[model samples]
Target: MGKSKEKRLCKQVKHDVLEEDLDGYKKLVVNPTHLCVKCGRVCNDPGLLCEPEPID
Candidate 1:
């Protein structure tokens, strides 16, 4: 009687989803999509968004 040995191979798959980018990120940059909604949506200015509303 002849017996054969079985071999098993396993490998890991790595995906580079997140990358380290510091080309232009060396300086502080203001986010344009950021909203300071403190007052209301009528105000388009970011600085004016923090204005207090008038009392009734």
Candidate 2:
């Protein structure tokens, strides 16, 4: 039997921001390209992705 890989929430992904992070930024991936919207089109490093939208 093979073990299934655990799904990581958005918070698990490293964003450029230091104070803000959560389990929703994973949606930033654009279709077909998988690019982050918050980081715009220039940023490539996941660690450099813009902070995820704040949760209220």
Candidate 3:
């Protein structure tokens, strides 16, 4: 797989945040239901995270 696809959203968002890519960030966190345990980043899809835990 390509590097981008291999990377979880948690890691990808770090770069997006650094570059101020608000649009990209928004697309990843539209309606977050899970949070990354490693970085505390929230996303709708748990598969996108390296370590995800349900928000509830």
Judging by lDDT against the true structure, name the best candidate: 3
TM-score of each: 0.17, 0.20, 0.70
lDDT of 1 by residue, 1-56 (tens): 23212210000001121133233222212233223334232222233234333322
Q: Candidate 2's residue-wise lDDT over 1-56, tens digit each?
A: 33223422233344342234322233434232323455433222344334433222
TM-score of 2: 0.20
Query: Model 3 over residues 2-38: C-alpha lDDT tens digits?
Result: 3456667887876666376677668779889999989
Clashes of each: 0, 1, 0
Worst 10 residues of 1 by lDDT: 7-16
Q: lDDT-based ranking, best first?
A: 3, 2, 1
Residue 47 in candidate 1 has what lDDT? 32
lDDT scores of the candidates, listed in order: 0.24, 0.34, 0.81
TM-score: model 1 vs. ground truth? 0.17
The candidate that wins on TM-score is 3
Worst 10 residues of 3 by lDDT: 1-10
Instruction: Compute the lDDT of residue 28 as modeled in candidate 1.
Output: 13
Better of 2 and 3 by TM-score: 3
